[model samples]
Target: MTELNISTTAGVFDATAAGPAEGRPVLLLHGFPQTRLAWDRQITALAAHGYRVVAPDQRGYSPGARPERPDDYRISLLVDDVLAITEELGWTTFDLVGHDWGGAVAWWTADAHPGRIRTLTVVSTPHPGALADALRTDEDQRARSHYMLDWRETPKTENDMLADGADSLRALYAGKVPQASADAYIRQLSQPGALTAALNWYRSGRPRHAIGTIDVPTLYIWSTDDAAFGPAAAQGTEQWVNAPYRFEALRGISHWIPEEAPETLNRLLIEHLQTHEEH
Candidate 1:
């Protein structure tokens, strides 16, 4: 893999990329507390399959892109960052894959720029409207998402997560990700202002624009053991997607699908990408 510094409106983003220059372009976005490394396995798999893969450490996670204001991490800006990176890469259209918080941003990007995104794949995060409704009316979803409250608490959340050498943050993987992999993620987040910038994604409240229907071909992957995103929201995700959509549930898998279930995710991604091959 080649390390790259991608310039965006917010700042230069740190990214890792692979595959041939002439291959089909694919953009992978990582979620909270993790860097572009989260897509390492898929990057290798997809690149080998002849797809140009690029994974960017979004917004606050990249040292150069870290903005101090909580509001700067809003979803709209986050979406803009992805578009900017792709535009800089000279990809007029590309396949997009995102996990956790990244999935949320991907949803918004696909909705806002339908013609620019060829195919959309989201892992472990439901559509914004599905999630918003569940968070408001579903007790189970609200209970599972209670951690968002703590994450929005600024210094307190950072202190608690950083305490005992970020043991709390490491626990998030729940034994699904290998120790070395988890360690890499923790180290990146341990950097000064890194953790807070990641949490800012949560503090930036959901905007009404995020509730629209996605018109591009889409795929939603959810694991049964995900602690934060519940099935109720996953089931309702289709309601917000007006385009062709497929939902896959990984039974007995944890939230860290990219690491723990890379093979399955890769296969699904290849199938999705092939089905909607850029013609």
Candidate 2:
């Protein structure tokens, strides 16, 4: 993989790319507490399949890209950052895939700027509307998402997560994320201002938005055992997608769907991309 620094309206974003320079571009966005390296496996596989994959340490995660004000990390700004990076790379339109918080951003980007996205694949996150609905009506979802309250209200959420050598953060990924990857995530979150900036994603705006229907072909992957989201939220996602959509529930899997099931995720993504092309 080649490391790159792309200029965006917010700042310079650290990115990684692979595959032929002229191949179809696929932008992969990572979730909270994780870096672009989270997509390392899929990046290699997709590149081998003739895709030019670009993964960026988005917004707050990238040292130079992080903003001081919480408002700067709003979803609109996050979407703009992705578009700016894509424009910087001369890609007017590209396929998008995101996991966790990245998935939320991807959904918003595809919905608000349909012209910039050709296809969308999201892992382990529900559509905004679905999330909003769940947060309001689903007691289980609200209970599961209790951590968000702490993240938003507590002043020391970051320090507490990082203290004790990030033992709590590491535990969240136990049995799901590989040891090396988990350590890398902890190290990234440990960086000065990194965790705070990331948490800003949750704090910058309303916790959820009314579900907006997306017109682009899309795929939603949810694990049966994801702790952060409940089945109601996952199943209700289809209501907000007006375009062709596929929902896959990986039984017995945890929230780390891409990492825990890389091959399955890669196959699904490749199939969706190829099927979209054929259609």
Choose the strongest candidate by lDDT. 1
How close is every model to the real structure, measured as TM-score? 0.97, 0.97
Off by over 4 Å in 1: 208-210
| lDDT (10s digit) by residue, model 2, range 1-279 | 999999876899999999999999999999987999899999999999999999999999999998877888888788888889999999988999999999998999998889889999999999988988999999999999999878885458876787889887788886689999998888888888888888998889763455379999999999999999999999999999989999999999999887999999999999999988743
TM-score for predicted model 2 compared with the true structure: 0.97
Span of ten consecutive residues with least summed lDDT in model 2: 203-212
List residue ranges in candidate 2 displaced over 4 A: 207-211
Q: Relative to the unseen true structure, what is the C-alpha lDDT of residue 174 in candidate 1, on a scale of 0 to 100?
A: 88
- Count of clashing residue pairs in every prediction: 0, 1
List model 1 lDDT by residue over 1-279, tens digit each: 999999876899999999999999999999987888889999999999999999998998889999998889877888889889999999999999999989988999998999999999999999988998998989999999998887889799999988998999998888888899889999988989889888888898767453589999999999999998999999999999888999999999988999999999999999999998853
